[model samples]
Target: MAHEAHSHEHGGGEMNWKLIVVSAVFLVIGLFLDNVETFRFINPYLVLLIYIVAFMPVGLPVMREAWEQIEHERDFFSEFMLMSVAAIGAFFLGEYPEAVAVMLLYCVGEGLQDRAVDRARDSIKRLIAFRPDFARLADGREERPEAVTIGSIIEVRPGERVPLDGRLLDAPAAFNTAALTGESVPRMIETGHEVMAGMIATDSIVRLEVVREASESAISRILKMVEEAAERKSSTEAFIHRFAHVYTPVVIALAVLVVVVPWLASLFSAADYAFSMWLQRALVFLVISCPCALVISVPLGYFGGIGVASRKGILFKGSNGLDAVTMLDTVVFDKTGTLTTGAFRVEQTVGLSPEDLAFVAAVEAKSSHPIARAVVEFMQGKPLATVDSACIVNVPGYGMTCGEWAIGTLRLMKKQGIVYDEALNEVAETIVAVAHDGRFVGYILLADTPKAGIFTLPQRLKAQGIKLMQVLSGDKQALIDKLIAGFHGHGFVKGYGDLLPEDKVSHLEALKKEGKRVAFVGDGINDAPVLALSDVGFAMGNMGADMAVETADVIIQTDEPAKVVEAIAIGRRTRRIVLQNIVFAIGVKVLVMVLGVLGVATLWEAVFADSGVALLAVMNSIRPLHRPRFEEK
Candidate 1:
């Protein structure tokens, strides 16, 4: 299921606004009776009763929670424990107004924290809404997406979303894939082309055969991955949790020392110091030393960062993935699917007759390779002679041969001693040599255009101090080199082509051995091995294979190379904001604790130290959610 049973509902359950209202009313009356001389006729005991009544609404819940922690979990030093103890201690010291106000402010702070988290969760939820709720069946009846079965032909009109992953059964049409790929460009998909869910048909009506169930669709899986991301904590979050475990008990012990040690020193030195005065300071110390700010703000910062990434069409599997992205110094890319569009088109046909084209198409039809598929797609309009595939011979790496005609790469031609013109080898396009029996027939040129803004991606990575950026592909070395040379202005450190799946992993392994934090980016299915082996794996979500999406730690939903840089920027910003909160929370609390114990800081200062700093930290966590300069669009 895309959504799960979350323990805490986003945006704290319906707030006790009535309780807050009652507390505020009693609090105002109590302060007026105590401070204003006009109300001096009212009994002091009655005013104390008003203060106690005001404290009850907010304080009772905190006290019960503290009690539950002690009785059930054998735990102390939680935020509830500190607030409850401090409030009760202040009340006993006859500081009734301070006690009531502390509880009131803490409740307000809790409400604010919950609201901040809710905002971040809602931002992410908006991105996951890409999945269409209904699919138009062939019979023109719209049904729930989950009820749509595989092999069911669905009709989608212009502006309607494709409800499930399917293969187009109708003629080619334009689709707006911004929701899926994060790019606004409309893509033209042909008949038999696979289309993912969450894409909107923008031009003409399109019919497709559902290839996957709703639960197994790409949109469903992406939503599921994002929903579960928060369960996996980062190293910083785990450390803060451990720190709270030890820090809380130690600070509580110190608060006890602040009271007993001062009173004992006063007795021994024969100095005039009231026990109540020392005890009041100790209560203030407990209030100031609460660690709610650090604990709550750190996780909220990571969530905010994840929300920002989702807006840019990037999905981090966890905060750890976001943390890892901040530390990445090296990035590896797969050429065909990662850097280039991976959609091959026929650029030119060389010295080929209609009969020769038919022969080439017949031989390519027997292969499942992407280049072969491109060849078959190009031969759609041309008249082709029908040839039976009863005796087709398959050859890996080289090409295939059907009876008399053989079609493949120049390497295959070289192996078979079929002579071909040397001029064909000089072209940058992927050359497919066609031969009949013992003689060379002709060659067809196929080209996969690089995606827009890909060249700018390397430069941006370099600007961010990414030390190494390279492309690894199984295409010809000359083709890869020519492609890299075209983008001479960008910082492409190296390009290695003619590599198999294992070869890519070997290169990545070598980089890891050099003690560098390596990130491998590719369309998941083809680069699964390398993606799994790297320190961090980034998958092209929009066009990525299922295996890649499942294995990758981060998925670029937009399939845009620039989003990688944006992801890194968000990661770095999140880490900085979290650190700022931790340091600021701890630093302010420590300073306030010292002042409180020294009798310089009062209950008013304690309230700000506990609740005010927490609000500030929560506000700081949403910094990354705003548009960064590069992501203005």
Candidate 2:
């Protein structure tokens, strides 16, 4: 399902190299008959016949395409029609070599550009490589993922990919999300959490209850998006299409004027203007005015940019997504998944000895509460004291206890008459009070810890010309303040917490009214509406809700905030290269056309210049593909 029924095959078919080779042989013979002394006795019409044969092999396809466009699409000013006209005009002027060379070299250039585009597309289609061929059910029978109905229980052994999006059952297990997220670290998904398809189980065998069907999974949607991205053209592409429609017809009119105006002037004034000379100049004008370079290179540049982003695990929904990235002025972030891990972790310890932590960890290991799990996970790789589960006592609302130890809230301390610091009530984070031998020990402060590399991401976005960075979360105001204080040294980021989904939308609407181009980054599952409201919505994961997959403008598969800056950098690079091609192509064409009118440029000279400029523009358009790996600033 990931590889779909899309075919990249151009309607023109593959490069007609056999046809080109045959045509080249005939053209060479024609040249020998027209100019060689040994063939002076041959009839001139036979020499013309040889050249027409040379032209048909390469020329007929273009002529057929032009006729079809005119008959079917009513598009008379197409590049196909322009090249066909130029070829026939050269034949009318008795310049047989120039006539055949124009179409021949054009086919060559077109073939090269098509190959380059195919390679760029192949880079993005690498996503299909992550797909698994079969799903193993709990009964040891294998089936296609599409046949596995929702709510079915499936078991995936270690080193296997999850075939469908499902909820983890039984126990927590680690999964390697490198294929989806581009991050190499193994991620542990707790019991009851949604495990998306394409994640490889890294350690122990895990069982899952399918929550979504194979056709509705994240990988399927992403593959569909990648296939449609090229069709959803950017603003520049739309503009170029409109420009060509008007520009080509006008250029054709000017080429006619290049002949008729001179002839009319010779009849009125004392000027000696030959009709044949002016007609040849008009042929040069048509050859130079072909819009091949501009038309092909513009899309080539954007495709190259898309290819670069895909390699780094970033997916832009369309080329317009690339354009939107360049205009982002203000960036809004969802705190939990965007800046922090959104999971509780022990931040610090107050006066707690290693022995006390060990005792607390050993006692906490017996519980299924989130806070208890946080303590157990944090104590990993460290020492822990032994405690009997039979002797441990669980207080319904306070905390847990074991032999000679009481761990809970201030209420537990007061109930047991254990005295502790009353000032600790002022702490904003979750506080775990510890007691050893019925005496007050110390406490542990826990909160959602920041992700590994988010500290540097704010500074990098600012350096990339992002005007302001802000955070809006449903987390408590005090906790939000603490998180902001943690980032205070790194950069200036505005924080606003305790906002509901609707409140976030209202705040962004106000920002939009004030003319701020906003981009909001979130986990996408919980904040799909706010993401949809933003100018550019950046969703964090491939495992998010179906609404998230549909609403987001860009998907950061790696779940990294830093990828946004990289997307912007790529947009800027693509825009610069596209502009260069537009100016370069038109500038060269205009200059050559003027020289042709003044009789300073020849037909073959104009032909070579046009082909050379196209080749160079295409070379420049593909520069994004070979760009070095992005450096994290």
Candidate 3:
């Protein structure tokens, strides 16, 4: 036992929980042996020595910490000192079993906390592993992604991730975009499509013409966001840290008063007094009020929340953003490129055969116009008939013309002397009027379409306690009405259109004046001002754009507005669990401290109040890492 104490003293033992288990087992055996006439020692001191030996392994680490605090930092009132005083006082009081139990429980609790922290940080470590470190050049030279120059070509082989943000050279391929978009379905791409750095080429070796340097890649920028995420603490986290600084010292001072005031009062009274009794009460008070849970558990919960969010492809700038999300009463959305896919898509096809549509798609495939691109995208699976590249002439103002089949606006139909019905002129939608030789084939109506996954988003946010949902757009009021009507107009959204960027800012300011905590969600590229102006700005659907990352409080790596619902759900759960830890931990500690001072609670209860509350708080802090209510994944 003497040798064990010497080793623990010099070895600088930390909170070694396995040693705690061993000591606990030794303590149980010592107590059992004390009851047996044959096994028990005759000398009471030798019997007490067994308990003392059991206490040494668990007690020395905390004693070492208290001594180091006194020696190096000159601070004697830390939590370690409080626990040390309590354990040593219990030994002096001849509460040998409790003296062993307190340190054992405290070490186990602390060890559990360290394990939770390591578990929470696992997601970040996964993020670091997720990044593709090396790029392969077309010539088979391997280089670090950051060293690769812009416009240089890199090869992404089968089962390898793209190493930089670049355009596909010539081969059409399928890529697993789950790292960027959070969608598991493979994204099929054509020759000129821009592929992001982390996308894994599913089947074949595909090459990319590097458009952005590796440092500027989406994954690199996201990594930067995540690594620095915990620096800005939540208001709750900040308050606890500040509270601990004053709270621990006050606890120690109160503990001293607990012993001294009673002894002073006894000096003036006729009542018999013992120094040991008052000192024991003070020691229990110190043990019960160490503030371990209050100091560490809040940040543990928030850090886990941040790590979990990052793993889901949602990057919160800090835990403060996570806290802010719970308070949002209003979520305002920008219509263009946010709620709706910004580009034109085929909304309707009138009088056009599937063959005519296919023919038209083949011709429009040659043009880079938004409407033409939309047509080709709509016909993704349908076979496109071949177009004659030799005689294909793109008239600047109108549209494309192959030999016999001409697909363009009505003006092109008039120019080609192809007579179309007068009703074609009355069509409100932007249309492609197809002409076969001199006969008019039917036209296709193109419109900007709403995204697929956002129908449940508004109600979900409302259920999250967000009161108002609205859209702000620069499009015409009529167009905005049309879009809102598609969402079942009377449902929840209030539309404001014909607004400039300044108008959007003023609208947000007006909502703020109404005492609303607003979160504005927009394509982070163009809404920099509005993004920065709101209570919590959510930047949507971009991975590689620097402006998107810099402008918003939260970055949704995928382009789904439904992710906003997931973000709110995650944020609320994290903050809720953190508050639970705070209330439960502090409440138990306060109750136990009072009981300890009144002599109603023993060292056993005080130990439970200190470390047991901490263990429960730590367990609660990890709840945020589980899937939120709405999350299936």
Candidate 4:
């Protein structure tokens, strides 16, 4: 059954491709016949027969789509209507080939648009499938399977999906959250730490008392937002809708005037103008005024931009959100998952001699504690041999140890009968004390390291005149300061630590008050509030929290910080194409309308002005698909 559904989707894509090719062929032939009189020697009826044959595939889809919209009672007349009217008018004038050509070109443009929409929606749908259906709970004696329900308080074993939004009730465990944050490193979640659904447990089994029900959980809300956002139209699209309303009526009126005014002028002035010539010019006017280019290409350009973004691992909900990203002048990032690697690492090791340090590292290496991993990684590659110790213990929020070497905070070491050296404890970095057989060995300092491309990110944002780079996070002030010290001193970079989800939203609101066009980038379930409130929200699409991805204006599929730059570039490019299409479509139609009134334009010229302009606009709108510019690491 799944294979059948997949095949159906594949067939849909194939059909669109076939339609585009067929329509392009018809358009080419139609243009050729218009330019070369030799092709006109063929009986017009024979030409008309070929034209109608070419029109079927293109016309069928347009008519189907238009019928769907009409069924839903949509007031806006679709591009299909413009194509249909132009074709019917051509047939009325016995210009059969032109009628078919207009529908064919219009269908090619619609096919491209449909494909782009499908690509963007498919990218987002993949994220929706990540929600787990079952939860495992820790009974007093053994693990038991629990039926998943919204708001059900359940225990999560190590390496299991968090079943609901809840607070941790057990000891700290390492969390493999790459699926939510796009950063593959595991994060440590301690007691009182809030974890959302979709994050996988990596180390020890930690119980979470569910706070939010499954239905009202962060993931559900985000999914709803994404689904709704797709329907929201942007300013340019709304303008196009209004333009079509006024433009369509005016053109219909002009077509009427074209027939009446020319015949009346010929009668009053006693000029030698033929009635057939005037009527032909009127038919040509109808063709030129179809507005297919503006109707088809503007939306197609935005749709193509969204598709291109999806290809690079960004999921834009719709064209409006995609368009808004280009206008943003400032970007605010969540400190933990957005700017930094969100993984704690050992920064320095101190205390015992090099060989003794290796012993402590070897023992600590087996543990999954963030501090333990940091310490072990610090001593990596050094020649160290140590027997496996008997008693391994972990002290949450402090450190861990094996046998006699006690690795923990200074307070923990003091409780273990080890004295903290005044000089050693005064270091600026995070300190974890080490004790050997009740004697002081030294301390290991751990910190959240910046991602590989982080330093360059601020510089790139600066170059784009994105003057604001702020971090809103729930991390401690000391940690936030230490993590961003290198970049935080800049006037444009600000760090706000100890922020709640609501705090981040409030901060973003303040930025808006200051007149900054803000874009919030985050990954956690907690980030959803700010994601929704921001002018534009960017989620680390790949490995980002489901709720955050759903709430975001754009999803960075690769979770690369630099892709934000690429998204902004796409928005700008799409806007440029939209403007060019509008200008070119309207300019040609206006010029041809003037020529028709002067009897200098023929029925063929009007058909080209209508369908050819639409084809040119559609082709131009898709040009950005070939010019994607991603940020370099």
Question: Which of the numbered candidates is closest to the native, going by highest lDDT?
Answer: 1
Q: Which has the greatest TM-score?
A: 2
lDDT of 2: 0.82
Residue pairs with backbone atoms closer than 3 Å in model 1 (clashes): 181-558, 524-548
Q: Please tell me which model should have the higher TM-score, number 2 or number 3.
A: 2
Per-residue lDDT tens digits for candidate 4, residues 1-633, read: 111222232234776677657766865676576568788776666655656667777666665555654566563445445456656777777666666666654444444544543543564465476466766654443232234444445776776777667788877778766544445668787687778676788777677777776776545554655566446666887788678768866776777777778678878897776765666666667667765567557776776776566556566777788678767888888877777776777766665678777777777776776666777778778876665656667776666677666777787876777776777555555677777788887666777777677767678886555777877778777666765677744777778887888888788888899998899899999999888988889998655787887788887856787878777777877887899988888889889988987889876566656656766786787776666473322
Query: Which regions of candidate 3 are displaced past 4 Å?
Result: 1-60, 63-76, 91-97, 349-362, 377-429, 432-443, 489-491, 631-633
Q: Score residue 302 of candidate 4 by CA lDDT.
A: 77
Q: Per-residue alpha-carbon lDDT of model 2 for 25-131, expressed as tens digits?
A: 99899988888898999999998888889898879877877776788778887777878888898888888988999887777666666666667777777778777
Ranking by TM-score: 2, 1, 3, 4
Q: What is the Å distance of residue 168 in model 4 from its true position?
A: 23
Task: For residues 525-587, write the lDDT of model 3, one tens digit per residue.
Answer: 668889999999888746324575588889887777777888888888888889899899889
Tell me the spans in candidate 4 whose CA falls farther than 4 Å from its real position: 1-232, 261-278, 383-389, 401-404, 421-428, 437-439, 476-485, 488-490, 498-502, 628-633
Q: Return the TM-score for each candidate structure.
A: 0.86, 0.88, 0.86, 0.70
Backbone clash total, candidate 3: 0
RMSD (Cα, Å) for all candidates, in order, is 4.7, 4.1, 5.0, 8.3
Assess the local accuracy of residue 565 in candidate 3 as a C-alpha lDDT between 0 and 100: 80
> How do the candidates rank by lDDT, highest first?
1, 2, 3, 4
- Per candidate, the number of residue pairs that clash is 2, 0, 0, 12
